[model samples]
Structures are given as C-alpha cells and as structure tokens.
Target: MAGKRCLKGVDIMKLRFLGACREVGRSALLLDDNVMLDYGIKMGEPPEYPVNGVRPEVVLLSHCHIDHSGLLPNLMDIEPEVFMTPPTADLANLLLKDSLKIAESTGVNAPYDAGDLHTFMYKTKTVDYRIKFQTHGYNVEFYDAGHIPGAACTHVTSKSGESLLYTGDINTSDTRLVSGAVEFPNADYLAIESTYFSKEHIPRKETEETFIESLKSTLDIGGNVIIPAFAIGRTQELLMLLDAYGIRPYVDGMGKEAYEIMMKHPSYLRNPTHLKRAFDNAISVKSSRRDDVPLESSVIVTTSGMLNGGPSMYYLNKLYDDPKSKMMLTGYQVEGTNGRMAMDTGIIENNGVLQQLRLKLEQYDFSAHAGDKELKAIVKDFCDRGTKAVFTMHGDNTEGFATWIEEEIGVQAYAPVIGEKFDLH
Candidate 1:
C-alpha cells in the first residue's frame, strides 16, 4: 500500500511518548500543545506511580478501558480540554467512577474522588468518528477501533497538514464484539500498539472451539466454568460467543450489576446487544445460596479479568475446591495480579482470609488485542504512502514487534521508551 500520502510543505505537529511506549499496560500518548490521544495508567502499578508532571495539552479518549482512559482524572491538574466519542465518554464515566470506588474499597487513598468524577464528566465532550474536529490548531478525526464498544483510533492532522494516526489499542480481525480497526486513506505517522505481535494467531474458529471444548469438559463433570474477564469489552464478547456457541448458562449478577451502573447515564449503551442480555439475566443470589444444579452445567463469567476485583473472587472462592469446577482466563493477566498468580500456580487465598481455593485452569486468547500479523497489516496500509516513520508501543513484546515491523512491513518502526519525544515536520 504505497503512493497514497500527499504531504507537501507540512511543518509543525510533534509526537511524544508519555507511557506504554514498549510496555503492555499504562498507555499515554502526548501530542503537540499537550493534546493526548490517551492519558492512562499501567496495570497493577499505581496509576500515578512516578508522581511526575504530565500536563497534557488536551486529552482525547479512544475508549473506556482503564489502561487507555484511567488517567483522565489527573487532568484536573492540567485541566486540558477532554474529548471522547459519545459512547466512550459514557463508558469512561462509569469506568472511572467504579475505579475510584474500587481503589477506596481496597483502602487505597486515591487522588480523585466522586466530586472529581463529576467535574471530569462535565469537562468531557463527545466527538464522532470519521468527522473532523478542531483542537488547538489540530484537525482530529476518529475511526471505529473495533477493540471495544465506542473505541476509536484517532487521526490527528496539524494545521500545517502533517498527520499522525494513534491506534490506542487495535484489533484488526475480531468481530465478536466490535468490528475491527478502520483503514485510513492518509496517515503520515502511525503510532500503533503491538501487544500480541510475533505470536502466531490462533484462528478465530480454533479459539471458539477451544473455549467450547473446555466448557463441555467442565460441564460433563458437573463443574462450574469461571471466566475471569474484563468487565467492559472482553466480558461481553465472551458472553456473546458462549450464547452463539450454544452454551448459555444462567448468567450471574455481575453483568446485571454493571448495567445498573450504566443506566445512570443519559444514554443506555453504545451497543445494546449485551445490555439487553444483562437486563434479561438479572438474577440475585445470596452468598450462601445453595447450588442445586451440578457445577458442570453452570457457567460464571466475572470481571476484573485478572481476578483483581468484582465477582471473580466470589466464583473462585465458591468453586475453587470443587474438582468439577474449572477456571478459564480469557484475557491477559498482568504480572503479579491475582489472575497471574493463579495461572502461575493454581492457588489463591480468599482475600485476607487464609482459606485458599484451587482449581484446574486453562487460559485462552479470549481477550482481543492486535497481534503481530494484524499489526503488520495495519502498518502496511498506513505506510502504503511511504509514511515518514512508524511508531510502535503499548506492548510488553517490544523486540519481537520491532523485528517483524522492520522485516515484514519494511518501515522505520521503533518502540520508544517512556517520556521520549520526536519532532516530525
């Protein structure tokens, strides 16, 4: 894909890497005049770990994933102009509010509170995809990222006509939830995330088949299938696949609890499919409720994805000891998180209590992130016009992506360290 770019006498517009340059989590992309594509925090690490100054010129959110959207609260210091797509804005509010609650519940004194959440919401303005908007002399356009509902990859063009595309987190070929990253006709700089690059992709059918087989095996022995999924995108995607693949279990309260939280918004949902499912399956069960059905036929999908919070702990505590019960993780469990600890060794104590739970576990790539082959396809398209340079970040797999991008895509792609800056004119 070459011969599509038309950059003539374009000057101005700079790119900066604030965080997640080569790391998998904590994504922050700073632009000229402090407009950020995402102001986020790292997983497991303190969201505001360094206590450094990151006053973005302004902030634009791609989606509501905490890693991509968590740092908006700190903008209270910068007080930058914040723009989000309508649904992304809505979901971000829910996510950030809940995040504050989670932090406080865990007795971690968070910087921002409910008052800051309200103020942040008031500052957040919604922008539409494919439509151009102006901010501090930059023309920014949005495209459906397809990684999550309301997620978008942004195309920012300087007043001087220099353009850069920041793919917050992209999925080139997953359609279970969102479609896929949109192709751009013009882009000078492509800042892409390479979370799963260098790994051979498992065919979608194979992934689904693996999930079903695991479920069937657990069900056969009367065990519960506990899926530790992130509450936002991956959880919904897994639920849809389970329903599509004919493994509908009596969904528990986690989805319902999340939706009730969503209903506080002026609009219902960015995508209403799973919202309706959660509404339909709003069943409440006491902690001591007895299980009449065997564990094999039951399914439980809980959030925090990495066993960090929400109903995941409850499911693990309840079913961990049962031989028929199984835990299948469908997302990346950050290192040192509860999910990683469990996967590393099938043991996790129930919170502060010393009582432990154990279960046979199998993990799959149920979580959708752009992998190596997918990143190559996007870069191939972006650099078709002979892009000036390619910037790769937002991954733990740095060297692997660097090699593939140079060899396969044939572009000058590099993953910069945190706080790095580039002057492209």
Candidate 2:
C-alpha cells in the first residue's frame, strides 16, 4: 500500500480505492482515512470482500444492492455510524439476512454473523433525500440516485471547503419503478460509476414493446414463459409492465418481500399506486403451486435473475428439456454466473449437475445504470459546473472511460486501482 502524501503549504485530504476498481462488485472507498463510502461484497462461488483493516468514524451508503451494501455487517467491530435512506435500511436488512441464510445453508463460513448484523443495525441512522447533515465535522447531503428505492448519491464538503460527490450506483434513465437521478450537486471533485460506459440500451418504450410482442408469441403457442428478474427493482418494473398489458404473471421468490418493503416507503417510488395495482392483480405462487406452474401456459416472474439459486432453478429444472418453453432474462449477467453460462453455452448447473437447456432464452436490457451517452452527459454536466477532476470506477472499461473523459471532456481523470491513494488539495 502507498502512504498518503501532502504538499507543505497545501491543505490536502486522501482518497483511497479500497475496491470496485475496473470491476463490477466489492465496492469500497476511504476518504481522509476516517470516512468510508460503500463497503460491499461480490457474489460468486465463494464470494469476495472489500479490503480489510481500515477503521472509519462514519459510512455514507449509496444504495441497498448487495454489491453496495453486502459487507456492511463486517464493519461491526469498528461500529461506524452508518447513514442511508429509510427504505434502504429496510431493504438492506432483508438482503443481508438472506445472505446469511444462504451462507448457513450452503455451509460456507459467512464473513459476519447475526451478532454483527445487530450491531450494524444499531449503528445505522436514516436520512431523507436533500436533507443536509453533519458528520465528523463535514457537511453532507443525499440526492436520489434513481437506481432503486432509497438509492442516493452522497455529496460531502470538507471543513477546509473542498467538495466531493460520490455516486454509488446511479441510473439516469427513468423506468416504471423510479425516475432519473436528480441534478447533481456542484462540487470540485466527482467520483462516479462507469458500469455501462461501453454499452447503450435500446430505448425503453421500444424495448417494452418488443418484450410484450415476444411474450404474446410464446403464450399464444401454449408455451409457459419464465421471466427471471432481480427481486429488488427489476421484478417490480416487470410487474407494472405486464399489468399494463393485461398479463398477470405468477410472482415468486424474494421479490414478494422486496415489493412489500418498497410499499412501506412509497415516497421513494415513481408510481407506487401502479405498482400496488400490479401486485394486487398478480398471482403469488405458493410452495404447492411450484410443481404446477410449469404445467400450464402461464407467465411466471421469479427471482435469482441470473438463474443462480432461487425459485428460478426449480422452474428451470422442470422446463429445461421443454423446447416450447422460454426463459427471458431481465438484468445484466455477471461473468461466472449461471445466466452468463446459459447465454453463452445453453447450459446451466441444475441440481448439482450440468444440464443443457432446450428452452429458448432471450435477454432484455432493463438495467438501472446509465448508458454511454447518459454517462457522457453526466460528466459534461459536472464539467460545465466547474468540476476539475473525475475518478471513474465500477466497470470493466474504467480505464478507457477515464481516458475519454480527459481527452473529450477536457478534465483531469483517474481510474484508481484498489489500494491506491490520491491526495486532493
């Protein structure tokens, strides 16, 4: 690890890249060695955690996704005062508890136990969007990030008058679930995610139209359609879409719980009434209905979006050999996940064995992250407001994205690697 450096006459603070450098998960960053932003873990066979051993006085969380909040419980020993939105706290509790359950059932030693979860919850403080507060002598505020319910972008101003904005996981595109991220706060420095720097999604209306057309075609042929989606935001969006088109899907898995949690905090949603109507009209699949859902020509929306381990696997096991059935994926499939495997080789691990799937597979771009154009617009907007430096992270093409920002946007940019520290004066 490199040591922090300072110029003799300049007031300087250090920003350390603890994780999420040119990668998608395990996000962590340390500011001034005493304040942390998003300590999380990557999900895979054994899972990966953020760099360990640095203690912070406070943590500013951006969202509730596992990649942004998974490893938070591990900080219980330090007992950092954590701040997040009310809905994020509830959703994080749901996800963290499920992670612990999955670990116990698989016999994998979890990084933190129930005791750690309790401590994490005890140290958590909820704050609303646009609300300004003080922590460790620095002024802080939250902006709605438009990724999921309670997701936020954190802006912090040091006592010395330097300002920094950390966008945890942002979406500048509006979906049925939430609106685009709010206008960014003007700051001297910006740390933003580059998740979709190399990709641009098809327009939302056109994508939905195509999705509905395909669904109708599959259902018209008497084939059961399985839509695998992430429980948090994607599932809810699909529900509203399907409801609008008069298709009632059989809802399953953790999405039910996630929906219930989001409903408790309607202020974070774009249209809570529409979501509630969709939920009411949808059929909730119980344990007894699992074996029968695939028997009929039905539309099923289930979780473990990557087709990893969830109710999705059970449906896959029953329909993998059926040529008439279909499985539509609605999220980004990280490398090494079952979704990627299915997309690449038409094979997936089912019931502890490799199986070739005969069911037709398709992927739709329902991502909550901003696309290449939106990213450029965000950078330009920040630059127009006098942002002098940009630190890009959380994507495979972070280095290239940084280069583009420097060359095209005329700003100083860096894609810091894990464990690297930079001085901001």
Candidate 3:
C-alpha cells in the first residue's frame, strides 16, 4: 500500500483542524476532506478564511452547546444539511434561537440570523442516540457523552475505510441526567477533548454536597441563591440535586425555562422521581419584566453561564441590590465574564484584578467533563495495538494531560494546532 500511488488514486481520510486544537471554545474539524463534523469555535478568529469556502457535505452537531454548534451560522453559501440526536436538536433549537435574539438586541451581528437559525432547524435531521445511521458517505453512531443531555461522542466510518471517534466534551462519570461516554474500539485517529486535562476535579458527590449545603445555609439565613447554569446539562442536574431537600424549595423563572427544554426530550429523564415530584410541588416561573426582587423564597437557575447575556443577567440585576440575596456559582466562570466579576469581588481577595469588584459569591466545580482517573479508565479498552495516532484538543488546562497520556499509554500523543491539517491513512 505504501509503495503504490494509493494516496492519489484511492480516497484517503485526512483531518484538518478548524478550531479547538489548543484552547477551549470554537470546535470544528474537517473529516474525510469534505464532511464537517462541527462548524463552531474559531479562536481569536479572523473575519474570513480559505477553509470557510469548502462546502460542507454534512454538519454533525455533537450537542446543542454554543461552542460546537456556533459555526453553522457562519457558513457562506453552503446550506449543508445539519444532523444531531433528537435531544440535541431540541436543545440546539432553543439555544440558537435564544442566541439569535441576544445578538440582534445587542446589535452584535453573528454568522446566522434568526431566519437562518430556523432554516437550519427546519432542515435538521434528528438521529436517535446509540443507533447506527447513514449520512452522506459516513456511517455514524452516537453514545451519550454524559456532558449534557443529548450530548454524544460520535463514531464515524467513511466508505473508503477510515474509522474515527470524536469525544465532544465527554464525561466518564455517571450523573443525574445522562450516561457516561461509550468506549471506542477502533480508529485511525481519535480526536479527544482535553478541557480539564491539567488538573483533577473534586469528587462529584463532595462538590454536590457542598453546593447544596451552601445554598441551604444561605437559605436558612433568609438569603436567596442565584445559580447561573448552562441551560442544557447543568440545570437538569442541579434541579435533581436541589430536590434532594425534602422541604421542596422554590425554583425561579430561569429554572422553569430549562424545564421546558427538558420536556422536549424523547425518553423519560435520567434523573430520579424525587426531582420530578419537586418540580411539580416547587418551582416559580419568573416574568420577562425585571425589578422583581426574589428574596428569601427561591433558588434561580439561569444561563448564559458566564453571564455575558441571558435571563440570568436580568435576574442578577434584579438581585444585585438586595443584601439578603447570594449567588452560587456551579461551574467555571471564564476570565472576563460577569460571573467571574461577581465572584472575584465578593470574596475578600486582595488580588488587583478582583479587588475593586463587588457582590456576594460562592462557587464549586461541578463541571461534567471527565477528570484524570475517569479519563484513564474510559480509554482502558484501547490499550491493544493497531491504533494509529492520538490527537488531543479542547483543553486549556494543558496542565499535564499530554505528558500523562504519553507516559502511561506508551503512545506518542500530540496536541495539534488549530487550522492545521493532518494526513490520515
């Protein structure tokens, strides 16, 4: 095969990194020369590029999250058909539509407008999770990534003989709403996400207990807690966790919005009945109007997790003036986001960046991505020979992930560069 002119005559799968190669956000990968698995996240991005012209044969969304699905709107004239699992489709619809409105009202233009969003939404073909289906030249299937509801680690095989797996923000732990990522058996190249590779996260149970107890203590002190969460995965899990309190606490309007998204799922929830019963008994739906101070009576879960823009910001605006109100941070707050602003100033840290900031804040790391040990166990089955190459992406905490994988597995792991292309057999 090596001696012959196979590369020119025969179809060979080549991977070109579109985004998410070294840093977090903007994840796009060109698979098999034409099929675009994801069209999102171009870091420190330019307004134009050459690969932008490559008409995508198909755009597969791993989940409805903004980072993975963000590029769909930016495509030029190519109206590539978009495909996602049913739950992802539902969540994407809501998220994109909401994102569209934000961009419009803020006078911030994005790739696609609301009309294009619906255009793609109407054309979206929703595949059921775990089922093998055919699209274009690829036979594809999905396994729950446990990162978000309907999120998946996609497996695709091209007709010309290339098979691969892409972990789209995977979580190895079993959580309230979804199952862990499925094991991969074969691939010429496995594109893995390394968002948390640098450091190990605290145990899930310990984090959850701390988050809840903090809220309970705040509530007991006659304080209201506002937890800004990504509407899809984090909100669902938090609802289930909060319901563990037997007294049946109140959920603000933001929680109601996420609950509507949950209702769109195909099957029964991955959460227990206690949460469902709590949803029935507790939970308050907030109004579109601001200025309602929800004090001492509720827990509000809203999104635009970083608090860049969303209903959560309005909620915060409503509560910022109230002394009895507290904000609980359940996930990572990016450097420049409002959540980070509130958190840094609230704590009496003498650090210059946060010294002048203001507000009462508390946080816990409850991210859904897999930690070190869990990631090792997930890839344990692939210890056998015959694997070709391993490339890691979507990690900022490059902390020691690359070295760890290389030393432990005896495989040469390389973190590729964004926008760089690689030749795969």
* Candidate No. with top TM-score: 2
lDDT rank order:
2, 1, 3
Candidate lDDT (C-alpha), each: 0.71, 0.90, 0.68
Model 1: CA > 4 A from native: 1-10, 45-51, 252-254, 257-296, 353-357
lDDT of 1 at 389: 74
Give the range of the ten consecutive residues with the poorest summed lDDT in model 2. 2-11
The model with the greatest lDDT is: 2
Descending-TM-score candidate ranking? 2, 1, 3
Residue 365 in candidate 1 has what lDDT? 82
TM-score of 3: 0.86
Q: On lDDT, who's better, 2 or 3?
A: 2
Higher lDDT: candidate 1 or 2? 2
Name the regions of candidate 3 deviating beyond 4 angstroms. Answer: 1-11, 42-51, 247-255, 266-268, 272-275, 289-293, 321-324, 344-358
Candidate 1 C-alpha lDDT tens digits along 1-425: 01112223358666667778667767887776477778777766444432247676668888888788787786775567888787788778878887898888889887677877887888888887777889887788888786776778888887668788888887867566566665664787888888887775678889889889888887887777887777776666666677666666544434544444444442323445654564455334444553642455678766668777676777777777777778888888777677777777676646755434556788898646777677788788777886767878877777677777788767777777777667765
